[model samples]
Target: MKALLGLFILMQIFIATNAQRVCGTEIYTQKLFAANPVIKNAWNNAEVQIASTTKAATGFAARDTAANEIIYIPLVIHIVYNKVIENISDAQIQSQLAALNNDYSYSNIDKINIPAAFASLAADTRIRFCLAQIDPQGKKTSGIVRKYTVKDYFSPEDGMKISAQGGDEAWDSKRYLNIWVCNMASRTLGYSSLPGGLANVDGVVIAYDVFGSGEHVRAPFNKGRTATHEIGHWLGLKHIWGDAICGTDLVEDTPTQQYYNYGSPTFPHVTNCSPNSNGDMFMNFMDFTNDGCMNMFTIGQKQRMRALFAKGNLRNSFLLSFACDSTLAQGSALPAVDTIAVLSNKPLPQNTGLKVYPNPTQAGVNIEYIGTLNNISKTVSIFNVVGNCVYTGKLTKEKAYVNMANLSKGIYIIQIKEGSNRLTAKIIKE
Candidate 1:
């Protein structure tokens, strides 16, 4: 019995050590590029824009002190499972969310383990995430969709993303960060669509066993950093080794290195292309290092991520995604595609100069808009504490009025959406 136990222990170690982090992002993107062809050029343009907009040509895209604020991303997790064990619990989902928040905000307790040489370079991305409070139909939701599939496993480039193929179709990609957790085929742990990929298939996919930070989760990949890493790819962050020998990841603070690093490499793990004693940034979240070994994203990476969310950038549409707030959901069904179409129509969210008045009042309220809202129909919808749309009307000229005398004395969300532009404020009806 003792010999059998020792053999099991050795087997566990062997499996752990032999397992490599296989991210299908590069191959997936290459196939996508081949299919669309034009997407490659458009993606290149987006990269050039990111490079041009980086702050001050600094080694790191230092936080925008003047305008830097926490950006909250709303997520919708599609769990496509073939077996009962593959359907992860809500606790596991929440655990992954917590881990993402910590790592992105640079609040991870493991930061202390980052090498002193690169510790100071880690930046607080000021990015946070939450499950969607509203579904694409504008109804209340837990933000998690569980669908059973007949297939035992899905390939990195398989029909796992399409509902017709037994997988759940993605919700509106513009308003929510859709993440699919399923059993990936082969040794691939996950893959993600880059910024310019097809909208219908835009998302990140992770293998079920490596998703959450929980005891049920397998080791090494179990810390929930797989999402963090794949999301980096979704947000336009390249692998630390740039997917090539001594390649560039487009981030300056990160040292140039030859190929990717596996397992926990020692400090100053110099590569053939190492420029200095401080070698490859094998500990970066973008590297293929074990989840426990990866701890931080350099300031340069934070900048690259931020560049996509800047004004008129690729990811700026997320700013108007009120799906994170439950109270904004519609009482009736509204197809997600229509809402997303409106979201995609705008050039960029412009300052609408919108205002809501008569707070804590006995009578009605006045919503005023003083910007380019003439041709575009700006509709105002009011909702109570619950996610029920109480009243809906159109904004005429520059202002619209809604009678609230019958409304109970309480707070309400006054929301106005015109194309992708949205104006929202809280008002009291007394």
Candidate 2:
């Protein structure tokens, strides 16, 4: 027992000293470029396009409207686990998604912690994330896939992304953000593929301990910012230091940073490279700070991300996706061509046709709908405030139990559709 306790203490010491917040983005990029020569051409072309866009939008006077447009990215988490604890709970996954949505859009409560000097530079990015409701085969999903594995852990080169290698195969890369969570071999925390890479291997891989917030998350990295930082790379933002001493991240507003900052540094922490400026933006999400310390993404970084989703850009396909629509339940096979057309425009009466009583439900609510046809395939979808369909099913009769017991407390839209008739109602989960 003494020996086991000592070993556990030693493990804690190792994790503290080598937190592995260092992203393997550049490392994976180098490996991919070497393995597949064609990737270099695509990456270079992407850079050229970004540069051209920047040139055209030079100076804040042009005042880009890109920030005004809200874009939602569908995410699917693949949990490859060896132990029972590694198969994290849905609440934990939801917590991480909440963190990503909040942090990426500058809605994080920690924004108040950022120094006043850097406040204006913080950007909303107008980006939101939702766990996919529609599977690639056009079936309903919880947006989480769990696979028990014999392998204790996985490494970057081990292809934790390949199903044949004891990892979950990625969903379609262009339409969804795929994240693999598992026990990482060695001290590595996480890694992500940059915007341009082989389609099959394109996504982010994060260690389970740092993948989310609350119960399953570990100390120092528990704020769930690890995934946020990695997704930043996946969205085309580089490290503030660009992985070198006195490096450039290609952003105009961020002061040049000398090196990545770790732990929590005092405010006004300037690097030698930018002695005249207000130091390094250590609190920026692109930095290597502990999750608690990192809070914001610069306006320049937002522009870079928005540019990637621009028309004709590599990530633009996601903007046209209909994966979260009610139509996924309309048929078994998705149409060959995807469309983002509006689903319905009919107005639902206030507590008339369908009644969702106990507006703020703790255990659950009774959804009673009247004046309905029988055996006509009545489908119900509950969308979160951000438009993510968290729950989907077919209403059996005139009434059903809309369970909010497991959902986080917030406002959600309950959408019911049957043939030509559609009804919408708001439900508050308390």
Candidate 3:
């Protein structure tokens, strides 16, 4: 009777601790794999290939070290908010970007806290993200899609990925990273569709309050690591604990962990499966630690992430995605005939708002074409302070980048003309 009671108590401990940091990714993927066994077969085969190819074999071309050029992913953040606070501010959204860049680039200052044992394994993934300047239809966009959702909470089965279900639809997952920030049901901080999952549901879903590092965001999770963790899964990384007891995450440098770690575990937190005195690498982004506790991705994990982008692999399509460079999105949208340019002298519509960012730009400037100016085809002309047209580009409802790297440092005027409507904004190139 005592043994039976002890077993019940142990099971309760497992159940209670498991609820601390809930991520639906593993559960979601397992359901997907069960529904379609072919997917599981394909994933297992791909893992074998990835392991061998990324193993630093002599004479083999490694995906990560190839030229060492950074990979920039274009993102379209879909904000589905039912409440005012759920509709996070742009500053909060921006804070998530800053956190991701710092984490992936190894530029974050908190990295200094990593234990000396695992510090040598830390890696700069060479991956970066940007709000997509050009959208799927070749239109100007702020790369932000905000829609009021009647459904206050979404489940992991992906009601959030379908517009018919009161959630915003995903963009072309092959070309742009679709991030849906909303209120998640079941206390799920976040979840993601893995590389081999259906494209329509491919991407990350972050709960609003835990999505960014901005003020008033939840403690222990406000540092934007939820997005980072889910995005890591989207990029083909498994949890450091491998979602199982004494399991393998498939990365060599990351020591095998008995199970997920929660809160802040003291250094040298040993487990039965630990390979050395170094113990578990709970600081890995793939672990279930709090946002501030998680800090690095190992070199082995970097290899796994970069492998998805190899030629003919699942994410190879991103290599050709020019969504990051809006200059290449020429005439991606059509304007209503009534909104055609009447004349450059036409008065500016009161509803039209023009916003340019990083005004004193060293190179690229993002011009967001929104409000009444959205979708209407317009001519974008850049003139020097002396009024000479030095550069010209096409503009529509979509946001695009105006390359000023080649132009001499000075003040410039950006003019957009559509029918009798004209909007002009001044920007300085530093």
Name the top lDDT candidate: 1
Which stretches of model 2 miss by more than 4 angstroms?
1-16, 55-67, 326-328, 331-430
In terms of lDDT, model 3 sits at 0.76
Cα RMSD for candidates in order: 16.1, 14.3, 11.8
Candidate 1 has what TM-score?
Answer: 0.72
Ranking by TM-score: 3, 1, 2
TM-score of each: 0.72, 0.72, 0.73
Global lDDT scores for all candidate models:
0.77, 0.75, 0.76
Prediction 2 global C-alpha lDDT: 0.75
Candidate 2 lDDT over residue span 96-186, tens digit each? 9999999988999999999888999999889889888787876656677766555689987746788688787889998889999989877
> Candidate 1 residues 189-263, lDDT tens each?
899999978888899999999888979788878889999999999989999987666778888889998877888
Model 1: per-residue Cα lDDT at residue 128: 85
Rank by lDDT (best first): 1, 3, 2
**Model 2 — which ten-residue stretch has the worst lDDT?**
334-343
lDDT accuracy of residue 277 in candidate 1? 88
lDDT of 3 by residue, 96-214 (tens): 98899999988878899899999999999999998887878776555776665667698878887897998888899999999998888866888999887788988999988887795
